[model samples]
Target: MTPFLTGLGASLGLIVAIGAQNAFVLRQGIKREGVLPVVLVCLASDAILIFAGVAGIGALIQSAPALLVVIRWVGAAFLVTYAAFAAKRALRPGILEAATAPRGMTAWTAVLTAAGITWLNPHVYLDTLVLLGSLANAQGSPGKWLFGIGAATGSALWFPLIGFGARGLRGFFARPASWRILDGCVAVLMLGLAVVLAAEA
Candidate 1:
């Protein structure tokens, strides 16, 4: 039980950070584009990564800096591309209103984009695979599994809250100004992440 609480706290502490993943999720939720599948992919991927970390795959991943380097370049490219789209949208705020906007982004596209954001980022490995894995193992044998479960539970809870909860702001999002603001923030965030990744790479 103690380990469970620790896992929940630790996982939430990490997961709640503002990042490309969370930003993408919020945008999807606001757009009403494949929200369920997007949320599912995010949570499921987190579950897999967290379990892999707990199962000791973290060591294997850590041993390969080359692999992380490859991921860094790919992730930076993806972020830069997405940031361009966000910036364009911010410039042309007319398409911001989903109710009047043309159909866009298929379910597969949303899922793939969400997956790319989750899997391509090297930081996901550092946080979920390495850091969370270390914390789970620190709980010793019995508590480790419990801790992993608790951490997975945290992801399951948090993604939904952020994903669905953003819908409550749909009224505000209906305003073009709101969309511009959101897209501008997303652009800055994505570009910033891309620059950071490229620098590290």
Candidate 2:
């Protein structure tokens, strides 16, 4: 109970951020396009990253400064490119309607998209392996475990919430205005992330 409670709080703190990957997940979820694969890939990736943080091995991800530098630049590049794509989508909101379902949706595409968004973004390592791991270690022993559990729980809980929650709102979101709003929100988030990446580099 202690570990779970502690984990819940920490996880919520981190998971609340609406990043590019998350935006994609929510978008796909709203469209009900290949939900299973997207959720699986996201949860599996989260489990791996969170478990790495919990085991303390995530601490070693930055052992090589050169490697870290390379990852940072690569991450920044990806974020910028991805952000451009997101911006384009936002500008042309009808694309989301075209992406509707069946015709262009596939399980493998969702997996690849989620995986690319998760693994390709060095921000995942920076946040999960480095930042989250460091924070957990700071707690020491039981507290460390508590924080890790909370972080992991956040991932586990969030994927389903984002997936299904979107479904529940499908009726309201069917509006083009809602699509514009969602795309605008996603665009803003991706652009902000892109700026952060540039600053980090």
Candidate 3:
């Protein structure tokens, strides 16, 4: 129970931050587009990574610096491109009538984008594969598996909360200006993250 609680708390601490993946999910939630698929992808990805970490793959990943280097560059490029799209949306805020607004992204596009955001970020690898893995391993054997389950549970709880709970903000987001502001913030965040990733590379 202690290991489980510890793992839950640690996972929340790491994932609660306003990173690229969270921002994307938030936007989808507000737009009410592909929310289920996007949330599921995020939760599933986190579970896979957390368990993989616990399964000792984290050490293998740590030994392969070249893999991370490639991921860093590719992730940076993807972020920049995403940022540009967000900036474009910000500049061209369309009429956002709750019942009439066009869907900004298809389900397939949202799923792919969510996957890219989750899988590409080297920071995610460090946090999940390295940091979480190391923490889980410290618990030893069965406890480590419990710890991994707890961490994955954290993701399960969070993604749905943020994704579905965001629908409550639909009234506020009905305003085009509100969308503009949200998109602008997302753009800045993506660009800033891209710059950080590039710097790290």
Question: What lDDT is reached at residue 91 by model 3?
Answer: 79
Q: How many residue pairs clash in each candidate?
A: 0, 1, 0
Q: How does model 1 score by TM-score?
A: 0.95
lDDT, each prediction: 0.90, 0.75, 0.91
Candidate 1 vs candidate 2: the lDDT winner is 1
lDDT of 2 by residue, 91-121 (tens): 7756756644345467787778788778877
Minimal lDDT window, size 10, model 2: 96-105
Leading candidate by lDDT: 3
lDDT of 1 by residue, 1-201 (tens): 998988888899999999999999988888788889999999999999998999999989999999999999999999999999888888874555542364568889999999999999999999999999999999999999999999999999999998899889899987788888888999999999999999998
RMSD of candidates 1 onward, in order:
1.5, 2.6, 1.9
For residues 44-104, write the lDDT of model 3, one tens digit per residue. 9999999999988999999999999899999999999999988887775343343226666
Which pairs of residues clash in candidate 1, taking residues 3 or more apart in a chain or in different chains? none
Q: Give the winner by lDDT: 2 or 3.
A: 3
Badly placed stretches (over 4 Å) of model 2 are 93-97, 138-147
What global local distance difference test value does model 2 have? 0.75
